[model samples]
Target: MFLGIDVGGTKMQFAVGVGEDVFVLNKVPTPSRYAELLQVVEEHCSEAEKRFEYAGKIVEMGIGIPGTFTKERVVWVPNIPCLEGQDLAGDLRTRLGAGVYLGNDAQLALAGEVWKGAGRENSNAILMSIGTGIGGAIMIGDRIVKGRRGAAGALGWLNLDASVPGDKNHGYLENYASGTGIAGVGETHVPPLSTYEIVAKAKEGDSFCRKTMDRAGHLIGAGLASVASVLDTEIIILSGGLSEAIETFKKPMLDSFIEYAAPGVEQVPIVKSELGNLSGAYGAVRLAMVRGDMWIG
Candidate 1:
């Protein structure tokens, strides 16, 4: 058995994995302070130890962070500000009295796909996580791309419009295409519709919402086109809350991709995540399996 934690801006997900099956333990609101975050995680770990069948059978643990991290320290977590510069893996190890591994959430999500979901048969793949913010991860010949500072696939910052100034925090692509970005567009006309509601309205034949989603889909496709051209990815996987609207986004996005992508790149298959939101948790377990030492005691 293994423990996997996926940390997000709004919520934190916990799961336990045994063999090929992964079971979610619980979810909790993410804390804003570093100390509180640690306490919450420890509490959950204690509960899992006492309540779950795995108990003493658990071998290793893995945690997925939404931002950049190194072997021992979390270098930069923008959404969860308090996590920056903390030695999260080390602290968790001490608190749990077991080995803990850390990985970038997007990267680990892709790992989960490769291990048990969509990318299982592909050695070269790309994943775009498009929820509150956009994140990316690339697997080239089975090796995950991690740039010098472990920020290689920070796709949200991809500049689509050079003429206008971009947001220093969320970046250009995220400003117009992410879930928050989509909701921002809806706010002007619909007055408080969420991205999901906007997509629903579009599906229900609302022209205004439909057009809005089309534009966003086109933009997302353009960004994906650029990525495909550069990486020559075998497959592109989409995950996150907004990906549920793939039915609305697919055609326009594919059309836009055909318009902008390099010749053969446009043919690359784009698919939804098979593991859905749990991809990160499964990937966390894979991370532990690959990087952590087996517990013998």
Candidate 2:
């Protein structure tokens, strides 16, 4: 059996699978501290084993974290600060007594898509996840590009304005195209609205909300165009929370993407994630399946 875990900012998802079928799944709120996070995982594992009647069966595990890491430690995790500078993989392996594999959540999502989702038929594709923040991965053939330091897929930091300095907010593509960015679109209200609220308002025919979403789509498209100019991948798969609002942004995103894309690159297809939010978990399964033979980082 293979166990997959996705550690996100607000939630942690766990899945157990044998071959291509996932037999068990669970979700829990993410704890703020590393110790609590570990405990939560352990508890979930125990519960899943009991619930699935897989007690005593040996299993390999794969974990996906939303940040960059080295072979021995996680160096940066913006949303989950407690994990920064920690040896998460080592700790998990020691506590769980299982062979553990670690990978970036975005890259893992791409792996899942490649294995059984939208990217299954495409050898070269890009998975761009636009949620609280934007994360991306580039797949060339069967392998994912994991730069020397495993930060190759941190596409959110891509500069959208050369003159502005890259920071947590403002200059990067993420600052303008992510869920947080979408929420910040019209901040004039006394109490700023959330991304969902903005989408709801737009659906109700609010012109300002509609225009804001349109702008976000255009900016996202421009960023994708930049990526295409460089990688020229066969397809672009959009994932994350905001992707649910694809109808509100697809046209503008595609328009700007094509307008800025170089020559034939514009013809590349852009599609929604077929795996939805489960891509990371599925990718974790893939990671566990190939644990000893491949280097995820």
Candidate 3:
């Protein structure tokens, strides 16, 4: 069996898969401290083994982390501060006594999509997760493009408006396009609400919420356009919790994307993820299987 873990800013998800079947799945709030995070992972692993009747069985493990690493040590983790500069994979392997592999969460999600989701039919694609922050990955042919420092798909940092240089908030695209961005925009009219609540209100005909979502869509589209202009991606897949509200803003997003995209590039298809929120976990499982040489595709 292959074990996959997706460590996000707000939550952590775990899954166990054999072949095409997922036998175990769980989620929990992501702990902020390193110790608590490790404890939670251990507990989850124990629970999975108990529930799946795989007690004491050695399994290949893959972890999807929301950060970048160098030499198997975490170098940058903007969302999870406690993980910075830590040897996460080594520590996990030591504790679990099993093979542990690590990968960028966005890249893993892209991999999952390529393996069984939206990108299964596309040769070149981009996957963007627009949640608390915007995370993205690029895939060319059969491999993910990890640039020199494995920071190739940091799409959140893409600068869309040059005039608003040096904004005191987060990065340009992240500040305006992510779930947090949507909530931030919604706060102008009333108290802050979760991304889901904002979308719900918008669906109920709240004009302010609708406008906020619309603005977010345009910004997201602009970011996608910037990427498409450079890579000429064959397809763009949107994931994360915010993607659940794609119906609200997809049209305006496509419109803005077409407005900014290079000639002929606007024709590229933009779609929602088929794997939904489990893309990262699925990708992590695929990575584990690949590293273990148990599956080839």
Candidate 4:
């Protein structure tokens, strides 16, 4: 058995799975303190191991954090600034007494989509997760396109409008298009609503909500246009919390893409992410158990 944990900014998902089928799982709110997050992992692992009698039987464990991780196990978590440069894999092996691997959450999520979800049938695809911030990953033949610095397919930070002031602040496309970003715009107006709730209210004829999502879709499409121009991928897979309203924003997003995509770069498919909320956890399993070389095959 293998264990995969997807660590998000607001929550954590633990999965014990063999291949694509998960046998056991758990979810918890994310802890702000870095050490407390580690404790959560230990607790979840202990419980799962006991439930499945997997203490010594589990050979490899993988964890995906919503930040940057290097091959040597160094992590640079931007959101969780306190956890920056922490050697998470080393700590996990010492504490859990097992082999472990660590990787960026976006990479893991793309891997899951490739192995068992939306991109299963395709070799080259891009996953664009619009959440707290726009995140993206590229999977080619089951291998994540992790570049020299392990920041491949990081479309969020791309330079689109060089003339736009503060472009640096919104380099990651999610900064402008993510649900969190949208909510940030209306922070002073209405009670805060999650990405999903905002879209829901829009569908129920909330004018403000509709405007917010449309604006978000426009910004996302612009960023995606840049991705398409560069990668020319098979498809763009949308996941994360805000993706629940994909049906609502698909046309508007596409319209914006049409307005932005250069000539001769048409025909790329944009579809709702097939894996939904489970991709990150499933992706974590792949990252944990499969070596970097193994995923290429």
Candidate 5:
């Protein structure tokens, strides 16, 4: 049996999968402290074992994180400031007593897509998650192409602005197009509704909400075009809470993407994700099944 754990910026999801069937083991709000996170994972592991027929110590466990895991299982999680360079897998193995694998959350989502979601069609694909921040993962022929230093799909470095040559991000793209970005847009307006609420309002014909999502969509398309021009992937799959408003945002986004895409890269399709929010956990579970797949392993 395998256990999958997805640790997001906001919450943590757990699941147990045997063969083709999976059981949503549990979901819990992620806490900040390292010890608290360990505690939660331990509880979930026990619960999953109880609910499922797997009795022996968790044979393999996979953790989908927001960033890369390097030597000694150190996790370089950026958004979750406190986890930077911590020995995540080693710690988990010690606490849980078995094999533990660590991987990027976005990469796991891509794996989920390829496994049973929208990305099943093509061998080469790009999966981007637009939410509190934007994340990307690249897969070629069923393999995630983690570049030297494991930063190939790190799109935050895609310079949208040439003026600030070294700027990690623009206040707009990082603070407007993302879930955190759109929420930052009206931080002082309408009581600071969440991106989910914003999309809900836009669906109800709220003009301001619609405009906010449209602009964000356009921004996202422009970025995606840049990626397409370079990689020329078969398709780009988008997911996250923001994608819920695809109806109101797709047109402008498509237009902007076409406007920015270079010549001859005409048919790179943009589509919604099929994995929903479980991609991360599913991907994590898949990662644990692979042997000798770790960095510096």
Candidate 6:
């Protein structure tokens, strides 16, 4: 059995599988402290090791974090501050007594896609995830594009509006297109709503909610256009929580893409994730199996 963990800002998804498909999956709320986070993960790993079908048999493990990191040490994780500067991969390897790999969450999702999802057979692809924040991963010529700082696909930092000054802390794209960003706009109404609630209301034909999603979708599409213009990737896979409501905003997003995209860029296909939210976990497993020594930094 191989273990994969996708660590997000608000939750952690643990998946155990033999190959491309998961056997068991579990989710837990993300703890604020690094120690608590490690404890929770260790507990889950122990449980998986004890499962009857997989008892005393483990091959490798991989963890995906939502920020920049080297092979074993985390450099920065803005959403989860406590994880910054931690050697999570080393710690896990020591505790589990098995080979462990670590990678950026979005990058791992792309790896998963390449292995068995939308990007299968494609050498070039892009992945964009919009949840509490926006992130992306890029693949070119069959290799993950890790910049010198290991921040190659930090898509949220893409600046669409250069005229107005943006948030000092968060990226402009993330400030308007993330789940939290959508909820921020929803909060301005007479009665506030969460991102999911707003999406549900929009599906029910609520005008305000629909407009909110449309605007966010437009912004997201614009960002994607910028990406497509540069890399001309074969496909763009959309995942994460906000993507679940894509039906509500897909039109506006496509419309904006057509409007801003370079000639021929509009033809690029943008699709939903085949693996959905578990793309990262599957990716972790894939990396663990194939690229255990792949130096992300």
Q: How many clashing residue pairs appear in each of the predictions shown?
A: 0, 0, 0, 8, 2, 0
Q: Is candidate 5 or 6 superior in TM-score?
A: 6
lDDT of 2 at 26: 71
State the displacement of the C-alpha of residue 220, model 4, in Å, after optimal TM-score superposition.
1.9
**Alpha-carbon TM-score of each model against the true structure:** 0.90, 0.89, 0.85, 0.84, 0.84, 0.88
lDDT tens digits, residue span 42-86, model 6:
898778878736445566888888778877899998889999999
After best superposition, candidate 3 residue 253: deviation in angstroms?
A: 0.7
lDDT score, candidate 2, position 297: 37
lDDT of 1 by residue, 1-297 (tens): 678899998899898877777778788899999999999988877777777764465568888888887778999987899999999988988887777888788988988898899898998999998888888888888877866656678888878999978677887888898888888988888367878888899999888889888988999899999988998899999998888888887888999988999989989989999999989988888877666431111
Please give, for residues 106-184, the per-residue lDDT of candidate 4 as tens digits.
Answer: 8788888877887778878888887667778887665777766666667678655667666555664555677667777
lDDT of 3: 0.82
User: How many Å off is the CA of 280 in candidate 6?
Assistant: 1.2
- Model 5, 1-297: lDDT tens per residue? 788889987789987777776667667888888888888888888877777755545688888887766634644666675577678778888988868877778877887787778888687888877767777788876688765545456654455766744544444355558878778666756677777778888889888888888898788888889988888888888887666668978888898889999886657889899878998888887777663263221
Instruction: Please give the range of 10 consecutive residues that has the lowest summed lDDT in model 4.
Output: 288-297
For residue 263, model 4's alpha carbon misses the true position, in angstroms, by 5.8
Report clash pairs, candidate 4.
62-288, 133-174, 134-174, 156-171, 156-172, 156-173, 157-171, 157-172
lDDT of every predicted structure (CA atoms):
0.84, 0.82, 0.82, 0.75, 0.76, 0.85
Model 4 earns a TM-score of: 0.84
TM-score of 1: 0.90
TM-score of 3: 0.85
**What's the distance in Å from true for residue 136, model 6?**
1.3
